[model samples]
Target: MSETIYERLGGEDAIAAVVDRFYERLLEDDRVAHFFEDVDMRRQRAHQTQFLSSVAGGPVEYSGEDMQSAHDHLDITPSDFDVIATHLAETLVEFEVEEADRAAVMEAVAGYEDDVVTVAAD
Candidate 1:
């Protein structure tokens, strides 16, 4: 069988780097930066790394709250989800991940859109 995205992306270390850059870009963007104003980024980043590693089929297990429960009170809109997804895609590209691998990763994240997005689109 082919390698998993986690293996292809260089496992936990690379995933950690990607998560850091993804959150950095998200925090810098005007559209989504406000959502993180009160968040504990260090913990968030750690959770995100575990989550992404899990998604990518790594050995890491995500011990954080479920997506729906995590975002239940965040009031996240579809646009917010899109922006975050875009940042993720860009960060993957920045790390020179292959297109197919990036698409697979994005698809994995998109699977949780309904759970993460609490608000309807306009």
Candidate 2:
């Protein structure tokens, strides 16, 4: 059997690093950083790690709220989602993950777009 993306991504520890960097980038970006203004980053990082781990086919189980319900209150727009996705993709690149593996991870996360971007584009 082919190696899972999680294995290819160096498992849980690596994913944690990715999440850390991703959040750093997110917080630095003024366009979307406000969404995290009141958020507890430590817990958010853990939740994100589990989410990406699941998306990467890892053994981690995501017990956080579902994407739609979790994000519904945030009124996330499509552009905000795209910016976050870009941050994630760039994070993967910075980590030197292979293109195909990055694509797979993005694809998995993209599936939740509808569930996440509740606010329509302007």
**lDDT tens digits, residue span 1-122, model 1:** 88899999999989999999999898889998998999999999999999999999998899999999999998899999999999999999999999999999999999999999999994
Q: Which candidate has the highest TM-score of all?
A: 2
Whole-model lDDT values for every prediction: 0.94, 0.95
Model 1 steric clash pairs: none
Q: What TM-score against the true fold does each predicted structure earn? A: 0.96, 0.98
Output the TM-score of candidate 1.
0.96
Residues 1-122 of candidate 2 have per-residue lDDT tens digits of: 99899999999999999999999999999999999999999999999999999989999889999988999999899999999999999999999999999999999999999999989895
Total backbone collisions, model 1: 0
**Model 1 regions lying over 4 Å from their true place:** none
Roughly what TM-score does model 2 have, to 2 decimal places?
0.98
Model 1: which ten-residue window has the lowest total lDDT?
26-35
